[model samples]
Target chain A: MIEAAKTIPVVRGAFREYYFKQARAVEEPGKIEQREFGYAQFGQAGMTRHLSFNSIKELHAMLVKEVPSDVYCSNAYYKFPTQPMQEKQWLGADLIFDIDGKDLDLPCVPSHTYPVCTNCGHALPPSDEKKEYSCPSCNGKKAERVSIPCSKCIEGSKKEVRRLIEFLTTDLGMQRDNIYVYFSGNNGFHIHIGDSEYVPLDPQARSDIVGYLSGTGLLAESVGVRKGREGNMSFIKFPRGGIAYGWRGRIADKLKIDGSSIIKLKHIVDQKGGYAGFKSELDKMTREMGVRIDPQVTTDVHRIFRMPGTLNSKSGLAKTRCADLESFNPFNDACLLGGNKVNVRVKTHVKLKLKGEAFNISKESAELPAFAAVYLICKGLAEAM
Target chain B: MPVQLMTSNLSSIRMGTGDLAKYPFLNEAGEYLRESGFGWEELDRPDMKDIIDRAAERIEVGVGGNIYDKLEKYEIEILTFIVSLIMVKSIGMEPVLKKYALSEARRAEEFLTQDLKQQSEMQKHSLFAKIFEDLFKLKIEVAEDGRLFKVRVADYLARSSHFHEQEWKLINRLVQGGHVYLDADETVRLVRNELSVLIYEKVKAMTLPTLPQAIKVKAEELRAKLAPRYEYRTSAVTEYPPCVKHAIEVMSKGENLPHSARVMLATYMLAVGKPVDEIVMMFQNAPDFNEKITRYQVEHLAGMKGSRTKYSVPSCEKLRNENLCFATEECNGIINPVQFGRKRK
Candidate 1:
């Protein structure tokens, strides 16, 4: 049973050193110990909840102790009367934003999705996940299987993050002093807005902010864009008011329709007219422009998030902060361990790019550097020898 | 709406400051700005960062009213709401803000009804902004007698379409004499979604002032004082279920706990073997309490004197639906207070 454990790649000495570094925890543990924390170790049972830390030392001690597969901490700071959380008072919580590439509706990247055999469970290479999305092992017995992401897919996610940051600063009055952005170590990014001004906002208040971003329940007619009251209004002329500076104005300008001409221009707005259906057109437009957000993560004050500076098990990448968001590259930046090599027994064919180098491996044993091999091993493409 | 003329000796109208007097936040620092060629004329200049820094430093020490004193009532409202947000969130000013907000909500109701001539969109938003500004930031209590009372202000505010549907219910209470006190976390709770949220934050940030420690402390102390005061008999309270404890606490504060809260309280007391007279006696703090009517109601619920069909204590579902459930961890899987106490055993 011990010998039958899954195979993974690691450089000659890097995997052990990475394990040691994590065990020792070179940096101060529980950097966000002031915030509430919960964890889930690799268990045969399932993910656990309500695991908290008293201080950074305790959290670091847990890291060395449990070596959890996933670690999470709440965005909130609470004064717990007891560990039971019954008598605890909600002091405040940080505003958080999460944009995921896996959740994005973008077309298939070159190496993002993977096709797996429904019968034999064999997954094809990411390159052939689309178009020829048939299992090579089972000989065309399965459909395409969606995987996490490729580097280019994450780049698309990064662009969304930049756009969101800009919207938050200009429209929501978020100060740069309080905003902290981190890669989720998988296929997305997590942004924490620790602005003092926002801590007091409630779930409903946060919901309103999220609504604006997602355009879930946006009220374009209620905005000052229309000249008169609803049912009796005139179109807003170009170079709109301060209120229409965001998408409400942009969408209107793009469609070249004003309130007065809205019904007359129904052909452009809603070609598939089904009596009183222009509103559907508006919904489509908002959906196109709106940024998809994980609402539960942001509004929940007690929500625990992935601990930064730890390993993201899915990708074998460190969840580190981006010093410069624009120049940040997670594939390279997430590699925290030093240059060390480990021999890996190849169990399956896999192609991966890491630290500015690309490698293609066949179904044969091979030795590679630490970062690249670790990526394959973590991805379960090889076994460490 | 009138173009009121500025005739004060310190009237810096011609200083090209663009309606600074109307705002009412002008002071020595403002005068210094005027003297140093740094009014609205120098507002958006890239070189004014140093001047802004000096101004910020002076304000940090708390001596200048230049920026705060001359703000128009409306401008002050937006600024106050922003500052009040900090106080409630960081400093625990829920009670203080609730008190401030209750009075302000009353004032806002009155303010909203007043037919001011030529109310522009800006003026309307300003009116709302000022109400909220005062609601969250200020700590004003002119008298103990007038500090709190009962009113159906939630119902009143709900009648008007101007306010958020959730607000009046959360904040206002039915005070006696057909008045209500707007005192709840709703002001602090509702600000993030309020109309001012739509305002350009960069523009709104200019009006915000750093809240001093004194204000926060005062709010915290008042909030501590206002913690749900319950005059329950100590011996009786120990055996009361979480729902009963919660209902009595709200009632003791002269609040009209929901109709279901009252029903649940009565039923629980009846089940606990408390006499109808004592149960009716418990309701005296409610502003709507009337002896004969309360006794009749309690007796009807007891099933001893009225309809003869004894009403069972509401299940957790009913209590939760009435928004009166305050279940502790031990209360889990227990439906009635009698069961809750037995489970503890």
Candidate 2:
């Protein structure tokens, strides 16, 4: 096993090189003085937070000096950013949404990611269902989870990002230019709505926005479906002017049929078995159409989000913004570290491509570029030579 | 003036004294009192006896689940509401203040429902639109048919967070162009909670003044009726499930307990053999506490009322469904909260 004492210097050195040369390139958040910054050093137990900076130069200096494993900035704007939580006097907060590939429950995740026992290195069969962390073979409580940066996970996450943007723009009526999209550096995306009407929304208001996105607690009766009073019979009913707004209209579009007349829709429902059968079809449609997001992240006004353009220690990639989402690729674009060669021991069958170069390494040990080596080391698959 | 001209002028104007009298908490009513040069000292005058008496009845009937009958005189109606706020403040009781606010809000909600249904097309600012905008800063529009009111989705979400009903969910309602559509009754219902909160803040902020003999007597009488009858007993039983403990903690802080949490707490307390009156006493600190309502509900749960069937404490599954369960490691592997700590016992 690679000791923390040995791996700490190797990873820390690689991070220091990036921060020293490219720390100034970190994107400066709006009203930097009002943001609360946080950092975690190499091998640190917890983050040091409640820190604020006055300017970009100060933030860049701190980054270069600390060379932290991770950097975060608050989504909330506070009167006293450095003060304790209750005293921070929150003025407002940017509405941020996180779409993680892991939460999507994609079929490809089980193949690309598997659970390995941290204690004995025993790999277990991966399933898309919730996994119990305990090792069946050794009964160890820890599991080393490895999620390879595959094209499927990325494309799956991007599709959700697109769906979210469509909801934000078309459904929520938010300006497209104000919505900022970023690669979360590992297996996800982050959307930030800054300097917009949504920035001033409180957590409860944000939770409502989350509810609109997730479509939780939807009642079928409220959306143009009701009972016909034949004791157990059900039928579809539309308003006098017909269903033309929100989920009702969205469901109507999903039916893929012409003529939304009451008779035609009712006949269609009857053809699909009955009210229960039609309800299942609509429910399935919502399950596909609902924008999946991490509710906790959006609801938390005080959360210190990973700053854009900063190094993400999870995969040795930058938290880079996607100006053109269709063409932005994380493996190619977010690989910010230099290509200097470094010797490392390969602990497993690792295959990854970085900066247009693919490395299919199954050897005991090999010499690899610093970015690839850092990625493997951060993932706990290899140690420094 | 000609009939057509008068009608056209009426459509573009603000609410009159009659409208303000119905919604006395409206800013215009306050302005009317100010412009009329009515002073707080006038409250102590013998001439204002009718206003003071009606104010006491407002509280008496308001706490009893109904407000007083409408007064014929518009000035007296506005004065009665103002005097009620003064009386509630002078009594210096939190529960009484909350109850008065709720009663007033409910009264306004009834009027608002009727007004929305009757509002004409030419009326530029309906009471519903004005109240939503002024109180919540919510941008709102009404359908031409007057059957529906549209509010921005953000505004709806902010106000509807406390609503636990499935029908109030955003997905259940018609949403178009970032706005949610509500029927007249639903729209009025949405304002009820916030209106109560706004009234409570207004009442709580008013300072008590030296009152005349009649008003002082009314305050003392109302205080005696509303005050707690027993000393609070902090339940020291740690064996209770985490859900019960959490519910008690929230109630003791004078926070509004969700309906399901109240059921969970009451039934769990009943199951543990606590007396109905004692369980009723525990709910006294709830923001909207009413002794008559709480006692009747508790007794009903204990099977001492009409149905004569006691309610069992809800299972862990039910509480989880209601989002009321706050399970911990000590909760063990029990399916129902009643089974928690049973093995150790």
Candidate 3:
């Protein structure tokens, strides 16, 4: 909980200032009146949702007046936006995919995260090596981990975003312009597909799409390596042309062989214990190739998604869209705070680079830029002086 | 006889008379009836006796879980199918309507499989595309080998939602360039349930005139056989444990439940001696419930399929570990949910 008496006002004032000046940066979603809106205020426990807005101006007015810690809009459209869920009469929803850096298997994770025992409050020194740590002092099994994402973590997430976009375009045949990418204002990226064809899909259909993207249940026979009817004979059957299409094409490309070289493909499978061994190889290939995504976010039609231009309460950064992802940097571009300096008392040793400046502060009272002060304050690492 | 369909692209095509006879539920078949000036009054004429007899036989065989005979004359085949639909509507029993639809769909599927196998490449291509689009609004394309069919990812997802097997999952299938590849048998099977649903909807919406005397007698006889049997074995809803009640509530809203919750509910229902069909009916409202798969799974849990090992309800401690326990203060403590109301009963 934020100490409501002390840091809440300071953080709220900063967020209020940003909204007053930059509310125009918020993009207006299509069919505004049909979408539900939600806002969470500072020091509040739950969100106030089932609200509707007719235009961006009305939404901006609320942002400036309420100074909410977070703002959200529904991905689904409804005939009556403010009605109860059962009566919402849902028409359709834009398909959404979320990729968070915290969920990835990054080797640099231990460098940014440290574990503390929940039972006895024992803290462990952070290290670069990857392993599960038990509490040394209390010998308790329960531990709470604290993570502060760095630039490398953000890059790791961006790599996943790139791979996902490639699959959306080349494999799914979604148009380039229809796929929108945004910095989630924290540690991840949010992809919104604007294609109307995808909007009306139900939860079951979206689960299948999720299965396809995540490569959950891929079968060995799909790529044409099957066991023969007679004794122990397994062979490779490719499409007629030496060049196959779809997953067959992908397998051919991975093996660097066309369909004409069935002999070579069979030889490769035989090297790994025939068809059964080749199945594992195919599984490994799909695991390596498939993109990581949060399945629940895509499948839930009733979700209230974070608005694009709203400030994320976790990092005090703006969730902004990337027109050109290659050149976009979240630290400089999405940092919405002005140059006014603020005084804060640091709670712990912290080091980070933001908006072309570096800070390495440790157990000291210091005057810092407003953006940096809000960042640390939001993270509970500092209190207003 | 090959049923030829003509189309250059995704547009609807002209289906032949033979096609109409094989798939009498098609919208074009309805159009063919209107064009031939057939009306409800024609059913009262003396010459319509053969059509009425065939319609009655259709329902009898449908309820017996067998496909009806195909008449030699194409016109009679089409007309008899129309009369069978009317007889089913006159009975107005939901279960019987579903059974009749399923049997008809099965018959059409058999003919469809033969047609897909025997037709030339060009003719088969258009027929496949036309039938899927007309019935389910699905888009299909021919694969490179000319032996398999491909459907758009969106179309395949909507059509295959009810399949529970790991092999039927979209990820497990051969997907390339946004289309899933399926052989002729697999492709036809994808639409079988949907075809049944289509026929069911049509029959349920009809306002049929009074059935002729012969047809009314057959409808009465079928109703006596097919109306839901008394549900005496099933316990009242109020006596169920809180966790079981929660599962039923979730399913009633067509909501998704955790896998453990589903297992707990299915096992508890089976342990209480609920019929497999009744257990299946309880899950009918779930968004992804497919009858064939649901029946197979329920029977499997009942120890009727594969290994014959009946599953017991999880204990309270197990449910608590799985976060499924919904205990309340009822002045009694029990180890398992099944034991909660047992002694009182």
Q: After superposition, how far is residue B38 of candidate 2 from its true place, in Å?
A: 5.1
Query: How would you order the candidates by TM-score, starting with the best?
Result: 2, 3, 1
What fraction of the native interface does candidate 3 get right in terms of contacts?
0.51
TM-score of chain B of each: 0.31, 0.63, 0.64
What TM-score does candidate 1 get on C-alpha atoms?
A: 0.51
Give the per-residue Cα lDDT of candidate 1 at A352: 66
TM-score of candidate 2 to 2 decimals: 0.78
| Chain A TM-score values for every predicted structure, listed in order | 0.78, 0.90, 0.91
DockQ leaderboard ranking: 2, 3, 1
Tell me the tens digit of each residue's lDDT in model 2 across A1-385.
2346767777778788888898765999999999999998887678999999999899888987888899999998999999988789998888999999888888776676757678865555446667458877789987877787589889999999999888887777677898899999888999998635677777656666676676554555755567667733777666433466566677777764332666777776787767667766776777678888887799889999999988888888999999899999899999989878888877667778999999998886899989999888777777788
Question: What's model 2's overall lDDT?
Answer: 0.78
Error of 2 at A82 (Å): 1.8
Best by DockQ: 2
lDDT per residue as tens, model 1, B1-345: 222224353233232223332321223223433354533433235563433333222222221112222233433332343333333344333333333334333333332333121134434433333433343332212112332212222223223213333223221122222233332223222332232232222223344344354444443653454444322333333577788888889999998787778988899888878888899999999877899999999998877675477888876633542346776767855755657756534
* Candidate 3 per-residue lDDT over residues A178-279, each given as its tens digit: 999999998889999988878888877787777677665465565556777864468777533223655556666898777578788788888878766887
Of 2 and 3, the candidate ahead on lDDT is 3
The lDDT of each candidate is: 0.53, 0.78, 0.79
Q: Per-residue alpha-carbon lDDT of model 3 for B215-243, expressed as tens digits?
A: 67767876776665423344443488888
Candidates in order, interface RMSD in Å: 14.5, 3.7, 5.8
